[model samples]
Target: MPSPTLTRVRQAYARIEAVDRPEVWIGLRPQAEAEQEARAIDARVAAGEHLPLAGKLFAAKGNIDVAGLPTTAACPAYAYTPWEDAPVVARLRTAGALALGTTNLDQFATGLVGTRSPHGAVRNALDPTRISGGSSSGSAVAVALGIVDFALGTDTAGSGRVPAAFNGIVGLKPTRGLVPTTGVVPACASLDCVTVFARTLPEAEQALAFMASPSGRELPALPQRAPGPWRIAVPPRAQLGELDEGWAEAYEAAVERLAAAGAEIRHLDLTPFTDAAAMLYEGAFVAERYTAVGSFIDKLIAEGDTGLDPTVAGIITRARDIPAHQLYADQDRLAALRTRALTQLGDADALLLPTAPGHPTLAEVAADPLGANARLGRFTNSTNLFDLAAVAVPAGLTPAGLPFGVMLIGPAFTDERLARLARLLQPRLRLAVVGAHLSGQPLNPQLLSLGAEWERTTATAPVYRLHALSTAPPKPGLVHVGEGGAAVETEVWRLSAEGLGQLLAALPRPMVLGQVELADGTHAPGFLCEPDALPGTTDITAYGGWRAYLNH
Candidate 1:
């Protein structure tokens, strides 16, 4: 479970205290603002006023204006004091959520890697060595750290999703315009979307529903049933380059799972998608960002903003060269390309792909700024670029213990269908525990690495025996039998098939991967005992669960 909430918001404030690193935030809310909001939430709960978000706290990306704070987008010179919150922020506020602060991002939301900000490189919370994907860096990290329950970020070419993937959280990029951007700093205004990041799919979706306008905007309906024997496409095999082998294997397993769940999978040409991505900078859409942040960057440079990161300047500089004539041609080509690409995906419920090719370190991003950031945008850049909606939910971890995720992309207004599919797939999160493997364990570096969430589960049924294998790395195995059985305590991990595949392959001899039946009669893949490896092993099932054995 996440850290327990505080009736006094100030108690919860402890999580926000400075960590060893600082890049996730550009600035924070005033002490008075935080205190007042916390008090207000407490009062509502005491008075039984029915707070929608209850104790939820959130942070907005730097570019979105929030009341009582500066909207800097990481450039101090470009700061502005807004009198009111952005429409989305206002929506969250009305829903009873407290605003924590403003988070760090690539200056003017120009880069995908978190290192492009002057505040500090947003390091991965799980492994301080890796980059916390961006430009929604701070928001995603904030949630990952449990300092906030949910956060608001922006997505244009993967800004929101990348950070979520990096931080091992759920990043929900709503359909274009699904959430208002009235007070936001636009990356590609026409393509920008205010996205959500949370620990689970339901939390993100709950915040999204609460984000609806008071006027009660109608949501798109979920497809009534399975996409009717749909023909879904995976990315072309040749372009799966630079991907971590774990992600590729995990993704393939996900494909198989989907096929089993009644969706047809196929491979389709990715030329159109790549062609569109090339147009983002190579074409005129660069001007849209300039139109949004260009004026500010120009003023900051003139007024002497020493805080603007160099790479941000370089990225903004490219926007200056996009000619007006080229924009029309690019738009025309984009329209045609989108039609072809959508047709390719039209026969399917949604497209599937790895959220990122691979995770990288902040140092790697710093060494080669543009290329590394671009590589992180592999599956994500095309979503908002083409005005499609995407929801990235946890698939689980690869054998290497790295988090792997898959995103479902669909046409505009299909947020409901996308969300339904995401929920239907939510049960895939069964997680098993040994030692600190339980929720809130300190040794869960791998859990944080793959963003494996803690789950509710029961022990394997009475047919299994638990044995602590004296293996070097330390692991346990479950054996099945009709006699001499004990109900061994175990955790059922809800994993993405992609994460399961790599984990399965890494099983050492004497320990085989197989299914274990749970107390509830549900089965999740787990470590089964190889008859050969049981020698010298102690049957500790009497302890009930591995946690009990470890505690003793």
Candidate 2:
């Protein structure tokens, strides 16, 4: 009598063994261990416990420690067995997620290409010959190939997002320090962030929320979701980097789609962001990586057991010569650049960009590792450097049938907002609720059960009236009155089309879903009262909102 979730977990393990992709995992937990965890979760479920992530399968990048697993950071010589899981991993486990294994990464978590590992390069999930972007390489591929529901990856300079872009998954890189790095091997300690990769934005956001620090300090107020039309910033056409024909076409199509879906696309100068990205590797921040593992690398070199990836070794080794003064200078420069970048993001909801310039074949990376890797991080490196939250989602496939992705970037703590925006790029609808259904209201649970996420609270465009409808539970109705009406307060929520249908079917009499215009002049599906049925309703437009009417 195994639950369906347990059945899926078993099926996932079987698929993992059947696939037999050795390069995807550096170390795997025994199937017995996973089963035991799943059984425990089922027991908890039977006891009536609510688990947000009940029975979800997940994997962690090798650098993020798991209890009883060797944390190699993709370098066996530097591997260490940790007695406890990384804080982020522990959080997921507590929420009922089962870890399958530790996935491969670029050696020392230094390279963006997947090949910088002793375990072997992680091939693209879709086409093995192409590169799987790294240093979170295998974590992305695991989720991409359906081996896991979601996986943990760390982002320093694009490791989390780049791999997701290449593999056609949703990658969420939370603001720096939002997820603790206690048990993770550092690349650039100050810039590193624990990121999540999943098939959908909501799933990724759920994992991120569970992993975030419980203390409010690391978790900022979740961004209030803003209903469309979203003000999306983009780089000028001339500023866009050169891309292969297939990627260029796909990226352009994505932009066109966003515009068609009611987004106000604004082109801006991207030099400041790009300039900040260059500083991650070219500036003194590189010293942070050296500080984390330089000694171990030196020891390996001295013993002539230099089992490290040559490219990663070279990158870390060069940091030794960075004088203290140079590091200070770069820090100052970075601070100024951060200010400029934040200023540029002033009023825009989010910046939209190609996740990577193009997808490169494994042969391309082998021929020119540095160049190929650099190109892959073009839109990603600056995200951490500037302390921004980012979500990379699959846009569609290239003409060559390879995946193409786009990233939505926003200021720190905008993880929730970015997820909301990302959903617009998918199959969902924006719903406006005027009464009872607002957050914290008695009827709010119904919307939550329908997978509805509150976008924002706004008002009608000074052309609507509020009326307290005569009903047993007592709900308010939003009525349109053209030019003489006062704006009525409303909360906008998002839901899948199926959820909308269910909501419409369940709506009580006199209440129907219709177009309601917001103050911004954008129309969303909202509750409206049938004019003939308003005879018994009380005019409460003077109070402005349902909550206000109730309080008065």
Candidate 3:
């Protein structure tokens, strides 16, 4: 049986079709397609599947190939048919996830204002009058509305992170080349990265892990899964621009939550970061985007029937004129700016910044497309351009009900450390974890030991089983058996780096950390045993937790 949460997800997808918004999708999978996927996932689970995101439904940004689906890329004039799935899509498919369909994006991955698509603008789920930030517009909406557990998008310059924040979700932009762009359309081949959008951090992280390549996985061989009082950097008050008082308040609340949980938060001047952001478009990078689609875009324009997004066309038009010498000069400047930004980061565990400056309405976006869009990318555009890895976590909603998000950015390969910190900060966050650290048990303490704060106001989906393993000192293994497990009660927890290290070092042999899908239809790191440990061990799926099993 599908977990109630997954059931609800299915029902929500059904309802979403009634209020179909083509602006968010270029091509949506039919009911039969979704049903076919569900049956396959059920089969995997029935056979004791061990894949990440098993049974999860996700959508690919239209720029990616999904095997049998056309890559519209929000531009009908530039569609292509690929015989095979994109690398990331194939990975997700292999993990037993169902592809809901392909979503719309900013045409050619060119704009942040969602409206650049030929399909139409993707509206923010919370407030339809508002714009869903882009170029990964539709992917964010699908996740925010629960139409899919998570969605895939590509980010060359904040396309992934911006839309995520606008739609109240987590957007994770891994290190460049980490998720493989082999099957994905390129905006800037060297800079483009496939990203994940989801309602919760755990979901996004789970998708990221499934998609992460060893070559691009930048996590340190840390001590363990422990969160600590991390030294975090933030935008200096002076550098805070374009005020959204509500976002400011939520940002402060997020800071307070971290402080309450013992994190050392520091405010630092982000002047250098601002400078780097300017370099992305103002320097050589814009030319890179032009170079990426130069021939295709040029051919269309030459035919005089180029219906490219006007703004995208304008951006590309400018790229056509840059001299090679000027491009080299800009590249040299980017190097200096990168050094300065890193120096500002200066050994802090991670830099914390608003995922977007504030939310902009569709009206505001339509009126001032470029400015409104740049405001959203102020903190994010510099990431990939400077070779940084980042993870955005929901900070909570502002008093005005707008979602506030904060991101932890680190030098390449720091995703593991950042995830640890985001976990510890979850209470101050509205994010959920459907993984192994569900609280009020031994494993729960492992989360606490890793600096994970609990959100008492929340609960998980009850889709997993609690197994009492035969390991020393004992450990409760929560596995998503999608078969006969009861609704297991568990708490969601967040952690930081120092905390992650401690938990990892403390882990005993035979009990390793692996992915687990929680009752909430989300995945998290949980206690996993190498097959050798399960023999002769009693199957305690009836009891939701180790404590419950022992009590009986």
The candidate maximizing lDDT is 2
Clashing pairs for model 2 are 225-455
Could you give the candidate ranking by lDDT, starting with the highest? 2, 1, 3
Error of 1 at 446 (Å): 26
lDDT of 2 by residue, 477-551 (tens): 888889789988889998865477568646876888899999898998988988888786799999999999999
Model 1 residue 302 distance off true place after TM-score fit, in angstroms: 3.7
Rank order by TM-score, top first? 1, 2, 3
lDDT for 461 (candidate 3): 46
Clashes of 3: 29
lDDT of 3 by residue, 396-514 (tens): 77667777778888888777778777765664322233234445444566666545677543333455555566555566655555556566555555554334434644566566666
- Whole-structure CA lDDT of model 2: 0.85
Give residue 552's lDDT in candidate 2 (0 to 100): 90
Q: Candidate 3, residue 310: CA error in Å?
A: 0.7
Model 1 C-alpha lDDT per residue in residues 1-552, reported as the tens digit of each score: 122123435544665665634567777766666777677677777787777876778889999999878998887777899999998898788877888889988878888888787788888878888888888888988888877778999888888887777677788998776688789987888888889998877678889987655453356674554435755578777876667766777877777777777767877777778788777766788888777777777777788778878877877767888778899988899999998888777556778777888888778887889888778776787777787888887676766665677788887777777777765444354555543345545545655555566576567678877788786656666788858887876655556533544454344567666667777877766667787778788888889877777779
